[model samples]
Target: MTTTINANSHKSLIRNKVWSRLRAVALPDSRFHHDYSSFIADFEGSSAATDLLQSLPAYQNAHLIFIAPDNCLQELRYRSLTDGKKVIVTTYGIRRGFWILDPEQIHESQWQMASVLDGMENIGRHMTLADISELPTDIALMVTGTGAINLKGLRFGKGHGYFDLEWAMLYSIGKANQRTQTIAVVHECQVLDEELRGEVWDTGCDFVVTNDKVINVKDASKPSCGILWDKLEDGMLEDIEPLKELEAIKKRSRAG
Candidate 1:
C-alpha cells in the first residue's frame, strides 16, 4: 500500500511537469485546454515525426501497423493509410475493440478525415481478436503517444493503461509478437533525462521519436507475458466489453 501510494504521488508530479512543458508547443483539444485536462496535445507540425518514421527501413518495409488513437498520433494514422499500409487502431478509450483501416476501402480524398476518432468509425472496419487472428504475422510497428517518457524508455499515459491492455490482448491472441517493433512519439519536452523503473505490465518502446530527433533506445522492455489478469484496474474487465470478450476467448483457447 505504501509503495503504491508513493508511486502514484510521484507520477502525479511528473504528469504536471510534462503537461506544462508540452502545452507550450502543442495545442490541447479545445474542450480540454483547461488547467486539469489530461488530453494528449496535438502540435501543428507533429506530422514531422510521422515523416521521420516513414523514412526508416522498418516502416518502409512494413505492410501493417498498429497505432494508438491519441490526438498526437492522428497524423501517423492518416499517413499510414495514404502509404497503403493497413492500420490497426483501438477505438477511443478502446471501448469498442480494434478497427482496421485499409486505404483501398476509402476514397483517397477521405483518408485524412478517416484518421480522426469519429471518421475512423465511419470509414474503418470494426474487428475482434478472432477476426484478426488471420492477419499476417509480420506486423511492422506498434506506435503509441505517451504522456511522459524517459531515456530509460519507460512511459505512462493518462493513468489508464489502455495501450498496455491493447498490447496484452493483441499479444495473447497472437496478433502481435516480439518481432513487431514498438515506438513512442512525443514532444521533445516529454522526453526526460531521469531514469525510472517499469512495472511488469509497463510495455516500453524501442524507439522514442520526438519533434526534433529519434532516439534509439538500448534496452527497452516489452510485455510478453500478456495481461496480468490479477493486476488489472478495478472494473476494467467489467466495463470494457472487448476485454471481457478477449478474456473469454483466451480462456477457451487455454482450455482447448
Candidate 2:
C-alpha cells in the first residue's frame, strides 16, 4: 500500500506536467476553460472516443449503466438515454446519494435534460441499492477524467477518488462484480505506456477507449472486497450520506 501511494504520487507529478502541456498548447479554446484544481481533459475532441464506446457490443447490450457526472460524458449519457437504457448517476457529492434515470420514467420532452447532472432532480428518481434488480450480465462503463492510465489497466481518477468509492459501493451491493465488464473512455493523450501498479482499492478497467484507439486490457483484476472504509479520510462518512447508509447496512448484516 505504501508503494502504491508513492507510485501514485510520482504518477501525479508526471500527470500534472502532461496535463499542463495539453491545457496550454493542445487545448486553449474557450470550450475547455474549466477552473477546477483537478485538470479535466478538454472535451473538445472526445466525440470520437464517445462514438467508439457507443459502437461497443457490451455498451449496446447493457440495459443499465452508471456513468459519472462529467462534462465529456454528457453526450454519452444523452445517447444512452435515447437508446432506452436505464442510466444511474451519483447526486452531486452523494449528498442526496444516487438516482436512476429511465427514459420511460421521464417525459419525452425532458429526455435530453435528464442527461444533465444539475437537471437530474427534475427528471430522475432517487434510488437505493434495493431498488436495483440484478441480471446475469450487467455492464458498468465508467466515464472518468484521468490524469494518467497505463496498459496494465491501472487508472487514476482526477484525484477525487469518487469513481473508486462508487465502484466499492456497487460491488458491496452485488450490482457489480469481478466478471462484470468495465471500460473507461479517455483521450489518446491520457494513455501512458508506463507500468502502473494497482492499489488494492483501485478498480481495473477491462478496456480503455481513446479518441484514436481501443486498448484491450486482458486479465485485469478489479476490486473483490469492496469499500475500504479504513483507508478513507476522516469525515468522509459525514460528508457522503450514502456512505453512512452503507455503514449502517454493513453493521446490521454483521450483527445478524
Candidate 3:
C-alpha cells in the first residue's frame, strides 16, 4: 500500500510514530534493559565500539565529527589524539539547535563529562558549529540512526530532528561523500526491515554500527542526490525555510 504525506507533516508524523514505538521498546523496564551505565559497559566491555571504529575507512583521516548524547546515556567520549590531530564533534544546545564544540575549549567544564564505555579515552571529541559553512569539507562526521527517521527501519533515534537537518545540509552542499562517512551507532534491537518514508530534505547514512555489526547503506543507483529535485513539491520548499534560501531552488522557480 502506497502512503502519501505532505513534507512539513512528514517530520511531525514520522517523529511521533517512531518515538511511540521506540519509547515502548527502549524506556525504563523495557526488554532491552534501559540502564545507561550497563549499556555503555556492555558496548565497551565487548569489542563493539572499538571494532566498529577500526573497520571504518574514514577513521584513518585526522579530523572527525561525533554527536553528543542527549540523556547522558550511550555516548562516546574522545580524548586528544597523540599526533595533535584536530577533531570536530557536533553537539546540540537547548531547543534542538546545533553547535560545534571547539577541541581547545573542551576543558571549560561547561559541557558535562561523557561516560566512556572503553577506548574513548584514546579518541578526541570537538563540538561542531551551528553554521555548516564553517566546517572543513575534507573531514568526516558521524551521525546516529542512519540520519533519517524510519518507522520500522534500522536504528531509529529518540525523535529529535536535529540529525536529519544536519545531514541534509551536508548533502545539499555536496559535502557528504566517501571522504565523509556519516555513521550511526545503535543497538541491534533498533534495527528494522521496514521501508522508511523520506521527503526531499531527508538524508540517509553511509553506514550503521551496532553492538555486533556494521552495515553500509549506500546505493550507487541513487547517486549523491538521492531524491530527485523535480519530485519536490512547491509547498515543500516553502515549509523548510532553509531549502527556500538555496540558490538552486530560487533559480528553478524563477525559470518555471
Candidate 4:
C-alpha cells in the first residue's frame, strides 16, 4: 500500500495535517454549527479558543470588531454582541459584502442566534463602502481564522482571498487601519513551525490564540495596503459585489 501526499506545497500539507487532527476529536453535543468537513472552518475546541480570545485585554477593550464568518468564530461573535461591541462581519465567502451587527439594536435574548452565519444576514444591517466611510467609529480588532500560521506572523488561508479583500475594502474606506489589532484563532495543531513568506497584503495577525494558550507575535511585521485594483484578477470583480462597488466608489472619488 502506498500513501499519497496531497501536493508538493507546504501550506497544503499543513492544512491536511490540521484537518486530520481536528477530525479526530469527537464534537461535543452542545455546539450547533455546520459540519467542519463541509466547510474550511474549525471544529472540536473552537469554543475554548474563543474563550481564550475573549480573555485578552485587547478583546475586552475593543468597541468595534471585525469577525470573519467562520463557524469557529461563531461563539466569539455571540460574545461580542453580549459584550455590547459592534461587530463588522462579511457573509460566507463575502458574497453579500459587509454588515454591521449592533447589540443595541438586537434584543439580548437573540444574541446567540444573531451571531451565527445565517442569523447575521437576517439581523445585520448591510453597508456599502460609502456607508462604512461615514461611520464615526474605527475598527479596534480584526479577527479571523486561517489554514496555517507561523511565529513570523505569516498566514495562509484556504486559497481564496476573502479575508484579505475584507481588510482591503475596509482599509480603502478608512474603516480599518494599521493600528487595528488583528487576531488569528485556530486549534494548536494549525500553528506552523516553519516560517512562510509574507505577501505585500498578508496583514498577518498580532496574536494567535488556540484551545490551550495565546501566542503573541512580539515583532510582527504587518504590511497593510488598500485595494490593489490592478491586481484584481480571475473574475474577482464579478464575484465579489463589494469589491465591484468599492472600485466604483474609488473611481468616483478620484474623478471628483
Candidate 5:
C-alpha cells in the first residue's frame, strides 16, 4: 500500500511547527509586553502598523474598514479611528457580534481607548449581523491576523476559526466581493518559506505586511460568496450565537 500526504495532514504539520516556534518566542515577558496575551508573540505589531500605513495608501483613502480586535492590531485600529474612518470591530468570540464604530459616535477623547476590547464596548456601537445585513455600508479594507502565513497568501488563525467565519458571514450578506481587499500583519518570522496547500473553504489574503517588507500576493483566491454550510461540522453553529442568528436571517431571506 502506498501512503499519501493529504492537504489536511500537511497543514497540520505546518501549524504545529509554527505554533511551537511562536510559543518559544512570543510568550508574555519583559521583552514582549507586561500585559501580553497568548495570541501575541514576538511580532512587533506597532512597527508593522507603521509600515502598513506608510506603504499602502489604502489606509488613508479608506472610508470604512474592518479590523480585528487583537493586541497586535490595537494600534492599527486606533490609527484608523483617529483618521476618522468608519471602523467595524468584532466582539470577542462573537459573544455579542459586530460593532460599527464611527469616530463621531464616540467622544473625540475616547477614540484611542475604543481601539481595545474593553473600551470598544462603551465607545462603539454594537450591532448584530442581522442589523448590519440591513445597512448600506461598504468596507474598503479588511485587516486580519495569522499565526503563520506564506508568500502564496495562505494563513491560519490561532486554531480557532473566527476570522474565516467572519469573512464567510460578510460574504454571505453581499458585503464582501471581488474588490474586497484583505491584508494580514505578521512578523517576518511568521512568513513561511514555501506555499501552503489551502482548502476550498480557506480564504487567502491579498497582501501581507511584515516589519521588514510589504508583500503583494499574486493570484490570491478568496471566498466570493457567503458561508460554506456544507463545510461546517455538526453543532458548529450551536456553539456560535452570531452564526445561528445569521443562519436564521439567511433562511428567512431565502424563504421570501
Candidate 6:
C-alpha cells in the first residue's frame, strides 16, 4: 500500500533530515567557505555558467539588485556583471543573515587583492535593509540558495530569518514582480525534489542556477506576495528597525 503525505508534513520531514545532514557536514572545518570558491572557478570554467550568465533575460536592463553566495558558503565570485549598470550586492552581517552593499564600495576596498574577495566586496555595496517601496521598480534581485533545502515551501535558514523578512517586505509593497527575479545559486548536492512547508509569508526564488544547470522557478506554486503581514506575530515587527521605517509600509498603513 502506498501512503500519501501532505505538502506541509513532507516538507517538515525533509527539512529536518536535510538540516541534520547539512549541520553535520557544514560544521566540521568551515571548509565550505573556501570550497565554494573552487566551485565558482569550476563553474566559470564550464559552458553552463557562461551560457546562463550570458543568457539571463534581466541582463539587458537591470539597474538595482541583490545577489548571494551559493549555499551558505562564501564562494566570493561576482556572478552579476554591472556592465556599467547600477548593481547592488546583498550580504550578511555578523549578526544578520543578509544585507545589501554598493558595488563601488567593494571596488575601492583593500580586499580586492584576491579575485574572490574582490567579487564578494564589490557585491556587498548594494546590500540594504530598505523596504521594497524604497527600491527602484526596475531593479533585479538574485538570491543564492543551496538546493538541499526544499524551496517549494518554507525552509529555515541557518539561524537568522533575514532572507524571508527581506523578501516578505518586498512582496508586501508589490515590488517583487516579473522584472524582479530572485535567483538561487547552488551545487547539485543541495537540490531537493520535495516541496517544503510554507507559512503565509514564505517566498521562493524565481530561478535556480548551478554549475550543471539552471531551473526556472517562476511556474512553481509557492507564495506569490512574498510578504504576508497579517501572519506576522506580535513583537516581530519591533525586531527589525529598518522595516518599521520603510516609507511604503507606513504610507499604506496610514492611508488605510
Global lDDT scores for all candidate models: 0.82, 0.73, 0.43, 0.78, 0.73, 0.46
Sort by lDDT, best first. Answer: 1, 4, 2, 5, 6, 3
Regions more than 4 Å wrong, model 2:
1-5, 24-36, 39-42, 133-142
Model 1 misplaced stretches (Cα beyond 4 Å): 34-37, 251-256
Which lDDT tens digits does candidate 4 get at residues 214-236? 99997665555777777665888
Task: Compose the digit string of candidate 6's lDDT tens values, residues 1-256.
Answer: 1222465456546555655444433422234443321222122222354356446775545656544433332333333433433343333321232344444545544233312433444344423345435755545654545424444423434323455666655555565554566665544445577644455455566666655777676453334555455655466556544455554557888999
Alpha-carbon RMSD to native, per candidate? 1.8, 2.8, 8.3, 4.7, 3.6, 6.6
lDDT of the structure predicted as candidate 4: 0.78
Best by lDDT: 1
Give the clash total for candidate 2. Answer: 0
Give, for candidate 3, the lowest lDDT window spanning 10 residues. Answer: 37-46
TM-score of each: 0.93, 0.89, 0.53, 0.88, 0.86, 0.60
**Clash count per candidate:** 0, 0, 10, 0, 1, 17
lDDT of 6: 0.46
Error of 5 at 125 (Å): 1.0
Query: Best-fitting candidate, measured by TM-score?
Result: 1
Total colliding residue pairs, candidate 4: 0
- Model 3 lDDT, residue 61, Cα: 62
Predicted candidate 5, C-alpha RMSD: 3.6
Sorted on TM-score, highest at the top, how do the candidates line up?
Answer: 1, 2, 4, 5, 6, 3
Query: Candidate 2 vs candidate 4: which has greater lDDT?
Result: 4
Candidate 4 is scored at a TM of: 0.88
Residues 57-94, candidate 2: write the lDDT tens digits. Answer: 87887788888776667778888888988888887556
